[model samples]
Target: MNYTPWDLVLDAGFLSALLIVGILLRARFKMVQAMMLPASIIAGGLGLALGPHALNVIPFSDQFGSYAGIINGVVFASLPFAGSFSFRGKLHGARKMWAYSVSTYVLQWGLGLLFAIIILGQFFDLPDGFGLLLAAGFVGGFGTAAAVGSSMEAAGWADASTLGFTSATIGVLVGVVGGLALARWGVKKGHAKLATSLAEIPQDMRTGLVPVVSKREPIGHGTTSEGTVDPLTLHIGIVAVVTAAGYGVGLGIEALWGVKVPLFATAFLTGMAMRLLLDLTPARKYVDGTTVKSISGTATDLLVAVGIASIVPSIVMSYALPLALLLAFGVVYCVLIFRFLTPRIFKDGWLERGLFTWGWATGAVATGLALLKVVDPKSKSGTIEEFGIAYVGFSPVEILMAIVAPFAIIAGLSGQFIVATIVLGIGLIFVALMGGGRADAGNRANSFSNVAP
Candidate 1:
């Protein structure tokens, strides 16, 4: 069906209603509050149940599956504008973070491919690309999965989108529930310094309602010299402009080279360039970081709901066995990473860092922050600060892994596996070098601060 502007409005309205319902459910239910599940995930589940594939209560458009990728482009394009990046005095932390993150990516990809080649492909009638759904879902979350799946679909991978969405949905559920379990375990083991009961958590957090004090705090301000357009309007206007430019850039590359590329990569690069330009000029004063984050957050919530709602039940059922196995393996791998790998990488605050990494690896960064709050409510571990520094280097690796890795698999699955295995080997070496001797060191003196890159 040809979607008109009104169709877009209807789709937005339906999604908004589901989100509200999800917030209400989460606020009213103690179990959901304990899980710390995002309102978006809950909303997505409701949408899936009531959507065309299920009860058919909502009149969703036939082209609904495509919305995830399109909205993902918007989210990515707005990211670089939402935060500032600097390398001054953070080079060491950035390198360590990049190594750790890239290693995880390589490990996840290698495991997925090995399993696919050895078992799934051998036993089932699934294609080689089936292996990639694991990392695409678990590491990259819904946005990366949708973007990569759409690209793969253009390259003749049937049902890739459905598989990707299904993987993402499962990853998110596991991330929330499993991460909570891990945090609780850490508290019991004396790894978490500050463990509080559910009653200790702020009422606003337990329920999705903002406290009066939080509402009163000012997040952003108007520019000193306002032009014809409003300051907030200008910020959003810049995001729209860059988003379109990024899409155009992706199209230009495809038209010129005839290669299918993920639009989010170019969008990200575009946003970075725009950020750099704004920083270099006086225009940076008018652009508020908080407003940019709000825009990105809004796009992400809608994308998650639409992505989950678009899952094809028949496709999920057909691959049920493989899906279950993949998810199970993912849980084990994450646990091992938290239990074994985390202590080795960071000298101090290993539990806090591990919990946060597990949360992000499985779901998204916000999930990691939520897990971190559970362990160290006061942020005494400095996990958040160090992670922010490390992300400057880590984000690019994420984009490359998400955008290029799948295409590499498509080009030559064997070649991709070989390269991934080699990368994984190198990553393991780094992990061993970073974690081995420090395992016995109980003092923070032997931490990453003392280690050389």
Candidate 2:
């Protein structure tokens, strides 16, 4: 049967519909537990059952092929750039904070590496050894794992893609669950008391809806009663300009450094830098606060919904087990680090809770807002400040992590698990040294002592 282009589009539509159904089921029926599997995955599972693997309604390859590019684009689009913004005091403390933050990051990375090596050797029945499979685990999570596995499958490796996807999925799951569990635990244990404390702040004092605050009067071309430019126009202009500039810069950087940083990343950084630059300028005063909030929310929501929907169902099924496991592991890890590590490392404040919240919930400043909302949904000041600082501060950290992650993949691919462990160990040491003076940094590092029961 000839798979027409229309057929491809139709398949994408079907997958999208499935995702929507899953979301509705979760909301309407409270289907599966939260901090468990994502709604998207559950939907994918349903699709798989109905597809050729079980019933042959939807062929996996055709569905996947139709939306690969779009799904990949969505992934990069959702990544946070310049997420680490802080007030002057936070910046001063950052030198100390780095110790814990870096350690936490490395701990996660190290666990992922070790998990891959152990699983590949002991479990998967591979023919060309387990180097690449391990690499897949370290680099991009389950999706990347699956991608690598698929490549290997073409080259005569059995279940390579499946194993890779499994590992990556495990990582994502662990990250989410671990992160949220920590959030809940922190509140239960007073680590999240900052949330309660933030309630004291009045609503008007919070971060206003404006994207930037400028000192200049509304003497420019367009002005509003809210004391700034038209919110809609400004937002559209910002998104358009930032997106274009980012792509341009990403291409330039790729050419100069011989490293392939995606355009979306470039755009994200560019957008962040632009934001900071605008904020620091005297012109910031003329921008309406409301516009900023609306723009940011729209961008994020669009990216999340469309991106998740476009990732054709076939890929999900092909790498189901590995992806599922990776996600599970990620959830577990997020909980562990936050509950056991964050409080010990950071002094109690909005900053502390904010860090824990953001680390797991998309690793972005949006998490700051969410944490703030949990504390006082109506207030914006403290939340905005936290979000701003986080957005700026996180950029460098993310870049650094992204750069280091590839190396971890390389080590995994080479089958030098010991070397991988050593490299990760050294990285953590640096983080500890940087954040070591802080009284809260956890000295009781995670031992392979217990796996999630």
Candidate 3:
């Protein structure tokens, strides 16, 4: 059957309804409240249950995966406009944070590939590109996995996309559940600055709803004229245009080099260029950061829900044992990074930084923010603000890892492993230089002083 635009609208409407149902269920259930699970995850579970693989209730359109990919592009394209990217004045902390982010990326890739080459390669008939799934799932989350996995599928890795999505799904669950466990552990060990009892959290927060008093104010100062475009519409239009431009740029690159680049990476760069252009123009005044953030948030929620719902059960089941091993190793690796490396590097708010890293490394930036809120509700730890600044320097490395690394693996799997190991070695040396020796003592003292409540 040829699906029309109305089919898209209908599918979106159904998902929106599922999202509402998930929210209501969360609000009414104690188990979900304790888990602090996002409505998106619940909605995704509902979708998976109702989808074709599980039941015959909901129509699983062939275009569902494409919807996720397109929305992922929008999410990345909206990012640069969502906040200011600053690189001035705070040099030391920013450099340390950047190093930390890159080190994690390199380590995850290196370790993942080593496991695949030495262990999985010996017993399993898997492709060389299988190692990339670790960083793709953990560091890049579902969006990058879906985007890059699609590219890999085109490059002749038949099950790459399904494996990527499966890894992402597991990463999200680990990020939420394991992160909460780590948060409580931090409190027990006196690492958290402000620990709250379960009963102390607001009902709305526990239930995943905005309290009446805490609801965000409208974006624009006043309503638009009857004939004029609404501020929200205007912001969305800008994102749409930028997203299309990014798609075009990706196509151009593919045409020129005969190698496909992930659209989200290009979209992010295009967003940055657009932001810079806006900063240079007077039109920047009309753009609201909040509105851009809202757009990105919506795109992310939809991407997560659809990405999870679209997972092929047979593919996941086929690679179950290897996938389980990869995820198990990832959990241990993330925990060690937080427990040992984070405190040695961050001079202040080590717990907050560790929690944030665990969140993003396991899931997405939104997960990091969620974990940050759980531990530091008032944003007093300064983790989010500092990480935002550091991301300016870190994002290019992320793009390279997400976009370039997969293609390199496709070109020569052994060569990619060698390169990944060299990068990981360099990352380890950088971490030692920054965190070891005299700096470790000063860092520990600063961390204690900052978190001593």
TM-score winner: 1
Error of 2 at 240 (Å): 11
The lDDT of model 2 is: 0.45
Ten contiguous residues with the weakest lDDT in model 3: 444-453
Better of 2 and 3 by lDDT: 3
lDDT of 1 at 156: 91
The global C-alpha lDDT for each of the candidates, from Candidate 1 onward, is: 0.77, 0.45, 0.77
Q: Write down the TM-score for model 1.
A: 0.89
lDDT of 3 by residue, 1-453 (tens): 898998898789888998898889889999988877778888888888898778858886768767877898998898888775665654344556666777887778778877787888888888777877887898788877877787787788878877897788888889989998898888777787665643445566787766696574664432245479877778889999999999999899999998676678778889889899989998887788888878888898898888788888888899888888878888898999898878776644588888989999988887787787777776666566567666876776676677766777777755656566567757654764455332332233344222211
Each model's TM-score, in the order given? 0.89, 0.53, 0.88
Among all windows of ten consecutive residues in candidate 2, which has the lowest summed lDDT? 444-453
Give one digit per residue, the lDDT tens place, for model 1 in 203-262: 666677785875655546666456576777877788888888988998898899987666
Candidate 3 local distance difference test against the native: 0.77
